[model samples]
Target: EPEVTQTPSHQVTQMGQEVILRCVPISNHLYFYWYRQILGQKVEFLVSFYNNEISEKSEIFDDQFSVERPDGSNFTLKIRSTKLEDSAMYFCASHNARGGTGELFFGEGSRLTVL
Candidate 1:
Protein backbone atom coordinates (compact mmCIF):
# COMPACT_ATOMS: atom_id res chain seq x y z
CA GLU A 1 0.00 0.00 0.00
CA PRO A 2 1.05 3.61 -0.59
CA GLU A 3 0.95 6.45 1.91
CA VAL A 4 1.93 10.10 2.31
CA THR A 5 5.34 10.72 3.88
CA GLN A 6 6.52 13.83 5.72
CA THR A 7 9.98 14.95 6.73
CA PRO A 8 11.23 16.45 9.98
CA SER A 9 8.44 14.75 11.90
CA HIS A 10 9.12 17.27 14.65
CA GLN A 11 10.59 20.75 14.50
CA VAL A 12 11.39 23.41 17.07
CA THR A 13 12.01 26.96 15.98
CA GLN A 14 12.22 30.47 17.32
CA MET A 15 9.49 32.96 16.72
CA GLY A 16 9.82 34.95 13.47
CA GLN A 17 12.00 32.31 11.87
CA GLU A 18 11.15 30.61 8.61
CA VAL A 19 9.84 27.04 8.51
CA ILE A 20 9.34 24.60 5.72
CA LEU A 21 7.57 21.28 6.01
CA ARG A 22 8.02 18.67 3.35
CA CYS A 23 5.84 15.84 2.08
CA VAL A 24 5.74 13.16 -0.55
CA PRO A 25 2.17 12.26 -1.41
CA ILE A 26 1.07 9.12 -3.21
CA SER A 27 2.17 9.24 -6.82
CA ASN A 28 -1.21 8.35 -8.26
CA HIS A 29 -3.12 10.99 -6.32
CA LEU A 30 -4.32 14.08 -8.18
CA TYR A 31 -5.27 16.43 -5.37
CA PHE A 32 -2.99 17.64 -2.54
CA TYR A 33 -3.81 19.56 0.60
CA TRP A 34 -2.25 21.03 3.71
CA TYR A 35 -4.04 21.05 7.04
CA ARG A 36 -3.15 21.89 10.62
CA GLN A 37 -4.30 21.08 14.14
CA ILE A 38 -3.48 23.50 16.88
CA LEU A 39 -3.18 21.43 20.01
CA GLY A 40 -6.60 20.25 21.22
CA GLN A 41 -8.42 22.00 18.40
CA LYS A 42 -10.32 20.73 15.41
CA VAL A 43 -8.44 20.08 12.20
CA GLU A 44 -8.29 23.21 10.06
CA PHE A 45 -7.97 23.31 6.31
CA LEU A 46 -5.14 25.49 5.05
CA VAL A 47 -4.93 25.04 1.33
CA SER A 48 -5.59 22.67 -1.55
CA PHE A 49 -3.52 22.29 -4.68
CA TYR A 50 -4.30 20.59 -7.98
CA ASN A 51 -3.23 20.77 -11.63
CA ASN A 52 -0.16 22.63 -10.36
CA GLU A 53 -2.08 25.54 -8.85
CA ILE A 54 -3.99 26.43 -5.76
CA SER A 55 -7.57 25.19 -5.94
CA GLU A 56 -8.78 26.71 -2.66
CA LYS A 57 -7.44 28.24 0.51
CA SER A 58 -8.67 29.14 3.93
CA GLU A 59 -8.17 32.48 5.61
CA ILE A 60 -5.69 30.84 7.88
CA PHE A 61 -3.47 30.48 4.88
CA ASP A 62 -2.37 34.09 5.02
CA ASP A 63 0.52 35.70 3.20
CA GLN A 64 2.86 33.92 5.56
CA PHE A 65 1.95 30.52 4.22
CA SER A 66 2.74 28.96 0.87
CA VAL A 67 2.50 25.53 -0.75
CA GLU A 68 4.29 24.17 -3.75
CA ARG A 69 4.94 21.07 -5.81
CA PRO A 70 8.55 21.85 -6.64
CA ASP A 71 8.87 18.58 -8.51
CA GLY A 72 6.74 15.65 -9.64
CA SER A 73 7.27 13.73 -6.41
CA ASN A 74 7.36 16.26 -3.58
CA PHE A 75 5.02 18.79 -2.06
CA THR A 76 6.01 21.42 0.50
CA LEU A 77 4.54 23.97 2.88
CA LYS A 78 6.48 27.02 3.92
CA ILE A 79 5.87 29.65 6.55
CA ARG A 80 7.84 32.80 6.04
CA SER A 81 7.72 33.70 9.71
CA THR A 82 6.79 31.49 12.58
CA LYS A 83 4.77 32.70 15.51
CA LEU A 84 3.90 31.21 18.89
CA GLU A 85 0.45 30.45 17.53
CA ASP A 86 1.98 28.64 14.58
CA SER A 87 2.89 25.71 16.71
CA ALA A 88 0.81 22.80 15.52
CA MET A 89 0.79 19.48 13.73
CA TYR A 90 0.81 20.17 10.01
CA PHE A 91 -0.63 17.41 7.88
CA CYS A 92 -0.28 16.57 4.23
CA ALA A 93 -3.19 14.86 2.53
CA SER A 94 -4.21 13.60 -0.90
CA HIS A 95 -6.97 11.95 -2.89
CA ASN A 96 -6.93 10.32 -6.31
CA ALA A 97 -10.13 11.95 -7.46
CA ARG A 98 -12.56 14.63 -6.33
CA GLY A 99 -16.02 13.10 -6.60
CA GLY A 100 -15.69 9.75 -4.90
CA THR A 101 -16.62 8.66 -1.39
CA GLY A 102 -14.62 11.58 0.06
CA GLU A 103 -11.82 9.36 1.22
CA LEU A 104 -8.50 11.10 1.85
CA PHE A 105 -5.05 9.74 2.55
CA PHE A 106 -3.04 11.64 5.17
CA GLY A 107 0.52 11.74 6.27
CA GLU A 108 1.72 11.19 9.83
CA GLY A 109 2.10 14.97 10.13
CA SER A 110 5.03 17.22 10.90
CA ARG A 111 4.89 18.80 14.30
CA LEU A 112 6.05 22.43 14.47
CA THR A 113 6.97 24.16 17.68
CA VAL A 114 7.75 27.85 17.93
CA LEU A 115 9.16 29.37 21.05
Candidate 2:
Protein backbone atom coordinates (compact mmCIF):
# COMPACT_ATOMS: atom_id res chain seq x y z
CA GLU A 1 0.00 0.00 0.00
CA PRO A 2 1.10 3.58 -0.64
CA GLU A 3 1.42 6.23 2.06
CA VAL A 4 2.24 9.91 2.66
CA THR A 5 5.91 10.66 3.10
CA GLN A 6 7.67 13.55 4.85
CA THR A 7 11.30 14.62 4.72
CA PRO A 8 13.77 15.62 7.40
CA SER A 9 11.67 13.82 10.03
CA HIS A 10 13.20 16.16 12.61
CA GLN A 11 14.17 19.82 12.39
CA VAL A 12 15.82 22.10 14.91
CA THR A 13 15.88 25.83 14.34
CA GLN A 14 16.55 29.01 16.21
CA MET A 15 13.80 31.42 17.11
CA GLY A 16 13.15 33.95 14.35
CA GLN A 17 14.46 31.61 11.68
CA GLU A 18 12.42 30.20 8.84
CA VAL A 19 11.54 26.57 8.15
CA ILE A 20 9.92 24.57 5.41
CA LEU A 21 8.47 21.11 5.82
CA ARG A 22 7.93 18.93 2.78
CA CYS A 23 5.53 16.11 1.99
CA VAL A 24 4.51 13.74 -0.78
CA PRO A 25 1.12 12.09 -0.74
CA ILE A 26 -0.27 9.21 -2.75
CA SER A 27 -0.51 10.01 -6.45
CA ASN A 28 -4.24 9.38 -6.68
CA HIS A 29 -5.21 11.44 -3.66
CA LEU A 30 -7.16 14.65 -4.19
CA TYR A 31 -7.05 16.42 -0.82
CA PHE A 32 -4.02 17.49 1.16
CA TYR A 33 -3.82 18.73 4.72
CA TRP A 34 -1.48 19.89 7.44
CA TYR A 35 -2.01 19.33 11.14
CA ARG A 36 0.11 19.85 14.20
CA GLN A 37 0.30 18.49 17.73
CA ILE A 38 1.80 20.53 20.52
CA LEU A 39 3.39 17.90 22.72
CA GLY A 40 0.51 16.37 24.63
CA GLN A 41 -2.19 18.43 23.00
CA LYS A 42 -4.64 17.04 20.48
CA VAL A 43 -3.92 17.38 16.79
CA GLU A 44 -5.06 20.68 15.34
CA PHE A 45 -5.83 21.37 11.73
CA LEU A 46 -3.74 24.05 10.09
CA VAL A 47 -4.90 24.00 6.49
CA SER A 48 -6.47 21.91 3.79
CA PHE A 49 -5.70 22.07 0.08
CA TYR A 50 -7.74 20.77 -2.83
CA ASN A 51 -7.51 21.47 -6.54
CA ASN A 52 -4.30 23.40 -5.94
CA GLU A 53 -5.94 25.98 -3.69
CA ILE A 54 -6.66 26.35 -0.03
CA SER A 55 -10.03 24.80 0.69
CA GLU A 56 -9.98 25.53 4.42
CA LYS A 57 -7.71 26.96 7.05
CA SER A 58 -7.66 27.42 10.78
CA GLU A 59 -6.65 30.41 12.92
CA ILE A 60 -3.25 28.81 13.21
CA PHE A 61 -2.63 29.53 9.54
CA ASP A 62 -1.85 33.21 9.93
CA ASP A 63 0.02 35.51 7.55
CA GLN A 64 3.32 34.10 8.72
CA PHE A 65 2.48 30.68 7.27
CA SER A 66 1.91 29.42 3.77
CA VAL A 67 1.45 26.19 1.81
CA GLU A 68 2.28 25.35 -1.77
CA ARG A 69 2.15 22.52 -4.23
CA PRO A 70 5.20 23.77 -6.10
CA ASP A 71 5.13 20.68 -8.30
CA GLY A 72 2.38 18.14 -8.88
CA SER A 73 3.94 15.69 -6.47
CA ASN A 74 5.25 17.71 -3.56
CA PHE A 75 3.45 19.80 -0.98
CA THR A 76 5.32 22.18 1.27
CA LEU A 77 4.59 24.35 4.30
CA LYS A 78 6.73 27.39 4.97
CA ILE A 79 6.91 29.40 8.15
CA ARG A 80 8.38 32.88 7.86
CA SER A 81 9.65 32.94 11.43
CA THR A 82 9.90 30.45 14.23
CA LYS A 83 9.02 30.77 17.92
CA LEU A 84 9.54 28.46 20.85
CA GLU A 85 5.83 27.94 20.99
CA ASP A 86 5.88 26.77 17.35
CA SER A 87 7.64 23.60 18.30
CA ALA A 88 5.41 20.68 17.47
CA MET A 89 4.96 17.60 15.31
CA TYR A 90 3.66 18.62 11.91
CA PHE A 91 1.77 15.93 10.03
CA CYS A 92 1.03 15.80 6.32
CA ALA A 93 -2.06 13.96 5.17
CA SER A 94 -4.16 13.23 2.10
CA HIS A 95 -7.46 11.65 1.20
CA ASN A 96 -8.72 10.09 -1.99
CA ALA A 97 -11.66 11.44 -4.00
CA ARG A 98 -13.64 8.25 -3.66
CA GLY A 99 -16.77 7.70 -1.59
CA GLY A 100 -16.35 8.72 1.99
CA THR A 101 -17.18 11.67 4.17
CA GLY A 102 -13.48 12.31 4.85
CA GLU A 103 -10.68 9.94 5.70
CA LEU A 104 -7.01 10.88 5.70
CA PHE A 105 -3.77 8.95 5.47
CA PHE A 106 -1.01 10.69 7.41
CA GLY A 107 2.74 10.90 7.33
CA GLU A 108 4.99 9.97 10.21
CA GLY A 109 5.31 13.67 10.96
CA SER A 110 8.07 16.28 10.83
CA ARG A 111 9.05 17.31 14.30
CA LEU A 112 10.06 20.97 14.60
CA THR A 113 11.94 22.25 17.58
CA VAL A 114 12.70 25.92 18.10
CA LEU A 115 15.35 27.13 20.46
Candidate 3:
Protein backbone atom coordinates (compact mmCIF):
# COMPACT_ATOMS: atom_id res chain seq x y z
CA GLU A 1 0.00 0.00 0.00
CA PRO A 2 1.09 3.57 -0.59
CA GLU A 3 2.11 5.40 2.53
CA VAL A 4 3.16 8.82 3.82
CA THR A 5 6.83 9.37 4.46
CA GLN A 6 8.77 12.01 6.41
CA THR A 7 12.42 12.94 6.39
CA PRO A 8 15.16 13.11 9.03
CA SER A 9 13.11 11.11 11.56
CA HIS A 10 14.81 13.34 14.14
CA GLN A 11 15.87 16.96 13.86
CA VAL A 12 18.00 18.94 16.31
CA THR A 13 18.00 22.68 15.97
CA GLN A 14 18.74 25.81 17.90
CA MET A 15 16.08 28.02 19.46
CA GLY A 16 15.56 30.37 16.53
CA GLN A 17 16.46 28.69 13.29
CA GLU A 18 14.28 27.94 10.29
CA VAL A 19 13.35 24.34 9.62
CA ILE A 20 11.49 22.70 6.79
CA LEU A 21 9.95 19.38 7.70
CA ARG A 22 9.28 17.35 4.60
CA CYS A 23 6.56 14.86 3.81
CA VAL A 24 5.43 12.83 0.84
CA PRO A 25 1.75 12.08 1.21
CA ILE A 26 -0.08 9.15 -0.28
CA SER A 27 -0.26 9.52 -4.04
CA ASN A 28 -4.03 9.56 -4.46
CA HIS A 29 -5.27 11.31 -1.35
CA LEU A 30 -7.09 14.61 -1.60
CA TYR A 31 -6.72 15.95 1.92
CA PHE A 32 -3.47 16.41 3.78
CA TYR A 33 -2.91 17.51 7.36
CA TRP A 34 -0.16 18.37 9.82
CA TYR A 35 -0.42 17.48 13.47
CA ARG A 36 1.94 17.67 16.40
CA GLN A 37 2.30 15.80 19.70
CA ILE A 38 4.19 17.48 22.49
CA LEU A 39 5.93 14.60 24.16
CA GLY A 40 3.12 13.17 26.24
CA GLN A 41 0.34 15.46 25.09
CA LYS A 42 -2.49 14.52 22.80
CA VAL A 43 -1.94 14.94 19.09
CA GLU A 44 -3.02 18.41 18.03
CA PHE A 45 -4.05 19.47 14.58
CA LEU A 46 -1.99 22.25 13.09
CA VAL A 47 -3.31 22.64 9.56
CA SER A 48 -5.12 20.95 6.69
CA PHE A 49 -4.75 21.57 2.98
CA TYR A 50 -6.54 20.55 -0.18
CA ASN A 51 -6.69 21.71 -3.80
CA ASN A 52 -3.43 23.55 -3.18
CA GLU A 53 -4.80 25.96 -0.58
CA ILE A 54 -5.25 25.80 3.16
CA SER A 55 -8.61 24.32 4.12
CA GLU A 56 -8.28 24.91 7.84
CA LYS A 57 -5.65 25.86 10.38
CA SER A 58 -5.55 25.72 14.14
CA GLU A 59 -4.39 28.58 16.36
CA ILE A 60 -1.22 26.65 16.81
CA PHE A 61 -0.41 27.44 13.21
CA ASP A 62 0.82 30.92 13.89
CA ASP A 63 2.69 33.43 11.74
CA GLN A 64 5.88 31.44 11.99
CA PHE A 65 4.46 28.50 10.08
CA SER A 66 3.60 27.88 6.45
CA VAL A 67 2.89 24.84 4.26
CA GLU A 68 3.10 24.07 0.59
CA ARG A 69 2.86 21.33 -2.00
CA PRO A 70 6.11 22.10 -3.72
CA ASP A 71 5.38 19.52 -6.39
CA GLY A 72 3.04 16.71 -7.28
CA SER A 73 4.36 14.39 -4.58
CA ASN A 74 5.97 16.55 -1.95
CA PHE A 75 4.32 18.49 0.86
CA THR A 76 6.37 20.62 3.19
CA LEU A 77 5.97 22.64 6.37
CA LYS A 78 8.33 25.48 7.06
CA ILE A 79 8.84 27.14 10.38
CA ARG A 80 10.26 30.63 9.89
CA SER A 81 11.60 30.73 13.42
CA THR A 82 11.59 27.82 15.81
CA LYS A 83 10.96 28.09 19.54
CA LEU A 84 11.50 25.64 22.37
CA GLU A 85 7.76 25.12 22.50
CA ASP A 86 7.82 24.16 18.84
CA SER A 87 9.67 20.99 19.62
CA ALA A 88 7.37 18.07 18.98
CA MET A 89 6.64 15.07 16.83
CA TYR A 90 5.25 16.46 13.60
CA PHE A 91 3.09 13.91 11.84
CA CYS A 92 1.92 14.12 8.25
CA ALA A 93 -1.39 12.54 7.36
CA SER A 94 -3.67 12.20 4.35
CA HIS A 95 -7.15 11.00 3.60
CA ASN A 96 -8.88 10.11 0.38
CA ALA A 97 -12.00 12.03 1.29
CA ARG A 98 -12.84 14.53 4.00
CA GLY A 99 -16.55 13.83 4.31
CA GLY A 100 -16.25 10.30 5.59
CA THR A 101 -14.94 9.25 8.97
CA GLY A 102 -12.05 7.44 7.41
CA GLU A 103 -8.91 6.77 9.34
CA LEU A 104 -5.87 8.80 8.38
CA PHE A 105 -2.54 7.28 7.44
CA PHE A 106 0.37 8.91 9.26
CA GLY A 107 4.08 8.88 8.82
CA GLU A 108 6.25 7.77 11.71
CA GLY A 109 6.89 11.50 12.20
CA SER A 110 9.72 13.95 12.04
CA ARG A 111 10.76 14.66 15.58
CA LEU A 112 11.79 18.29 16.11
CA THR A 113 13.99 19.20 19.01
CA VAL A 114 14.86 22.81 19.68
CA LEU A 115 17.30 23.91 22.35
Q: How many clashes (backbone N, Cα, C below 3 Å) per candidate?
A: 0, 0, 0
Candidate 2 stretches with Cα past 4 Å from truth are none
Question: How much does candidate 1 score in TM-score?
Answer: 0.96
lDDT of 3: 0.95
lDDT of 3 by residue, 5-93 (tens): 99979999998999999999988889999999999999999999999999999999999999999897899999999999999999999
What shift in Å separates residue 29 of candidate 2 from its native position after superposition? 0.3
Tens-digit lDDT string for candidate 2 (1-115): 9999998799999999999999999888999999999999999999999999999999999998999999999999999999899999999999987887668999999999999
List where candidate 3 sits over 4 angstroms from the true fold.
98-101
Off by over 4 Å in 1: 98-102
Could you list the CA RMSD of all candidates, in the order they appear? 1.2, 1.0, 1.5
lDDT of 2: 0.95
Q: 39-100, model 1: which lDDT tens digit per residue?
A: 99999999999999999999999999999999988999999999999999999999988577
